[model samples]
Target: MVDNPKESAGRCAQVAGWLTAACQAGHTLLSEPEAKAVLQAYGIPIVETRIALTEDEAVQQAEQLGSPVVLKLLSPTITHKSRMGGVRLVLRTAEEVRQAYRAVAEAAERQAGAGQMQGVTVQPMVTLEGYKLIVGSFCDPQFGPVLLFGSGGRLVEVRRDTALALPPLTTTLARRLLERTRIFTALQHGAAGLPAVDLAALERLLVRFSLLIVEQPLIRECDINPVLAAGDHLLALDARIVLHSIDVPEIALPRLAIRPYPSHYLEN
Candidate 1:
């Protein structure tokens, strides 16, 4: 995603523009698409996704992404989509895609109430053969910005295998953080027939994610759950960002070690 330095800088400006408007509007929580845009701007790899408001449009989007697509109800209120039965996966045909779209919309209506359904997101159904890891940041009352890394997916709460690090991480520091996790140990030697996880790639992801937080001080909290890893591939499965209201100039800068989004760069 951050393949070119020039392009990456431009994307950061574009995302900052979006965040600026949202801040002026006094919105805290960003929609999934907004969150993904932030991640993408920072060079974090994410699944190709599109929004569809109708069954036919959903099918069209699915076709564009190719076969075996997934549809999930996209609503700000319905964060835990899987829990609400709002996720439909592995639609092999156009008809299946149409039906899945309807199913997800219906599920959102049933669980989240009628008007809670915003739309549906279509993404390629990724089949990961390696570990799913979590990477995120949240503002600690005492510590300010803090980074999180460890086991993810369905087992996150059950396993509770995570480690904390401060932002602006170096490759060495990121590797050390990885060393503190159980999944890292398992991934080092290869586990259960799966190929050994790409430690370097994971480390880079942690470092880049740290940079995102360092540069974007308005981000109060960000969750990149289930960063799918296989060999050398890493992709963010889902992401969300909570922004603080930048209503006052004094409160604009978070009590963070790193500076806010680079406004000077935007002037270039």
Candidate 2:
């Protein structure tokens, strides 16, 4: 179904306003929930998440999300959550959820003292039966916004398999970008008994992502990592967005690295 123009515009405005407020507050990073919300507003599929202010609330949220939920610490001062042991995944029972909750809360209290950390966020478990992909964008001093697609997850740095392209992308352009990567071949022809990815769906995601970076210039860096590619769909399991205020007029911003896509290209 086609999206209502007014509704779509409203969502965009809300996201823009939130980003502006965050930047004005001198915040460099968006909390995970906030980042996921921004991605959701832009038609990106994300794992639904909710905050729990208390241990009982955490269990309730997890129960509502169903069994095997993941709980992540909600702390502004803590960036390396995994290192700090703030992430607890695959809790299959209410009792497990309670234990995990205390662990993360205690972790936060130790690191930032009392009341420094907000409660935890509960998200449903995502399927592990897919390739882990990364979609990202960053503002280059000379090239303005540049897009990235590659092998993601914890090994992203070690693997270093990636491709770069200038945004505004159409399906064909996105396909070409994918073709430039080594994983594209594996994605087309499944490896190690895994099924082939839903390439069209992934390409559409890339197109929407390109438009996000192109239109939302305030987003200095956006990372959607470990995008699960499976079941004839693509879902972003996690996302992070960093914003910066534009110092100059739109026209005075750095030029594109390559020729721009046609005006009609955006219509499709």
For each candidate, give its TM-score against the true structure. 0.88, 0.87
- Candidate 1 differs from the real structure by a C-alpha RMSD in angstroms, to one decimal, of 3.7
Over 112-196, each residue of candidate 1 has an lDDT whose tens digit, in order, gives 7888877888899997787888898998877779999999986798999999988778789899999998898777878888888
Provide the lowest-lDDT 10-residue window in model 1. 259-268
List, residue by residue over 191-219, the lDDT tens digit for candidate 2: 87778998888888898888777656678
The models' CA-based lDDT, in order, is 0.81, 0.82
Task: Please list all clashing residue pairs in model 2, or write none if there are none.
Answer: none
- Residue ranges of candidate 2 with Cα displaced over 4 Å: 1-11, 109-116, 245-268
Candidate 1 lDDT (Cα, 0 to 1): 0.81
Supply the TM-score for candidate 1: 0.88
Cα RMSD for candidates in order: 3.7, 3.0
